[model samples]
Target: MDLDALVGRARSLAGGGATRTVLGLAGPPGAGKSTLAQTLTAALGDAAAYVPLDGFHLSNAQLDRLGLRSRKGSEPSFDVRGYEALLRRLVGEPAREAYVPDFDRSLDEPVAARHLVPAGARLLVTEGNYLACDLPGWREARGLMAEVWYVDAAADLRDARLMRRHTGFGRDEAAARAWIDGNDRPNAELVERSRDRCDLVVTSLAG
Candidate 1:
């Protein structure tokens, strides 16, 4: 996948006048965004932290309260207001370190006060489904990033991966298939429209 290329580019951004700006990676679910983010953060060392958009997802109770559980991955299901505030804070470059939550998929919960970015960090690699979007306040997201990347993969392959993920999470095979075909695909289509907003198109080879 030539992660070194991305690692080197991000490392250089910290050296120059760049204020450890955010790099947004936008892609559909099961698109390997977390994999890429984790890999890049490790490759970049202390200069960067992987800030996830998934942490902004509303809790299950919140979704149930809003009647948005069936549309969980949709844009309307997240705490966009909170996410915007966090982005504002990061862009403000506060002198003190701030704590951000990380989404723990195995537990299907957001781990509180887990990931922290030091004020002097040189770069932040944020990955999520909505960063490159143009819906409502979502458009404001692009303005907060120094750069963006979009990942594209074969649809069949994506579905295969997603179905396996759902089944691994204990869903029955029929339910897993339905999720991949219905909700996931619709969200993927919507997310793909934002690819035009990216600075780079990353087409990864399977490892």
Candidate 2:
């Protein structure tokens, strides 16, 4: 996406007379959804706060109980209802100080109440793999956002990034490839299904 255009839109939504705006960035793993969302929030500074979907990931214990730890990145592994509820709080019934959880990649765990989005905040920037999906709860998310952007990148690029990310987080190359091939890629495909619903389709980053 053109940095100028994206920044312009963010500034307008943040500065305009609108009450509160929730912006969602959805895409496959390694599509730069998180990075773009962070940059956009930074552009808007205090007017924006981030809410990541990863923090809502079901704990390893819960996944183990369901026999789904192996498919940890899949849509079913998330707390869709919790995310929907938070979005509602962020937009429909915003408050003065809203606390949110953050995910620690190194620990593969969620740290609750790590961040706060103050009341009267202008923008709520949320990023995740399944925000725009046609699935039951995800449909509720699409309803919550004032705008959603789907980041699109090449499959090879995505794979490379995924592999690198896995390795960086302590996985061996083979294990990383296996995880990507067995788990993440399928999740990416499933997440991609919701792209058509995005208000904007971003193809590249702006300088």
Candidate 3:
């Protein structure tokens, strides 16, 4: 939880290589993966760029067609192949500018080109729920990262944060609880199983 120390570590990763290095943060939902990614990117400024896995969420139409609407945030609900391709491009073409996608909680959909990894960015910070997963496309994506960190937090705290997120995004309290119990909890359990695969385990991040 030492802010300055974490910043120094991230800076080292940024400068550690000739090609752009990628630092991945993997954790269950509501474990503050995005918060830590943003903190590092902000501290490093132009030297860092961010790409979030939420951007690869399947559209509602596609979810419905695939009969996965009820399990929207599950692993199979993401376009893992596209995410892997983007990461590959970032690692392979360090000199090129790459547009990144993001998920809009307000619209509950993925938006294209919401972020940019400009040429000369020495580090690319990407965060997601499945970076450490041993599955096919996820495994390929993980192989491209210089390091992967597992962010951890109390389950109760995560549940509270998730409830607020769901309600803030239009779900009623009751519906949010139901969805969390039915969908998010399972996803988190699956994600937690990959914790041992990460290079580091982050218990918390300094604000």
Q: Give the Å shift of residue 68 in candidate 1.
A: 0.9
Candidate 2 per-residue C-alpha lDDT over 1-207 given as tens digits, one digit per residue, 9 for 90 to 100? 488789788767662444678888999988988889888888888888888988898988999999999898789999999989988877765556788887888988777998788776788899999999999999998898888889888888888888889999999999999999999989988978888889999974522
Q: Which of candidates 1 and 3 is the stronger one according to lDDT?
A: 3
Worst ten-residue run, lDDT, model 1?
11-20
lDDT of each: 0.79, 0.85, 0.92
Rank list by TM-score = 3, 2, 1
Q: Write the per-residue lDDT of candidate 1 for residues 34-82, one digit (tens) a residue.
A: 7888888888877788788888888888889999888877888877778
Best by lDDT: 3
Q: TM-score of each candidate? A: 0.92, 0.94, 0.96
TM-score of 2: 0.94
Which of candidates 2 and 3 is the stronger one according to lDDT? 3
Candidate 1, residue 48: the lDDT equals 81
Q: Superposing all C-alpha atoms, what RMSD in Å does each candidate have to the true structure?
A: 1.9, 1.8, 1.4
What is candidate 3's lDDT per residue for 1-207, written digit by digit as tens?
A: 476877888888884445888899999998999999999999999899999998999999999999999999899999999999998888888889999999999999999999999898899999999999999999999998889999999898899899999999999999999999999999999999999999988875522
List runs of model 1 lying over 4 Å from the truth: 15-18
**lDDT (C-alpha) at residue 19 in model 3:** 85
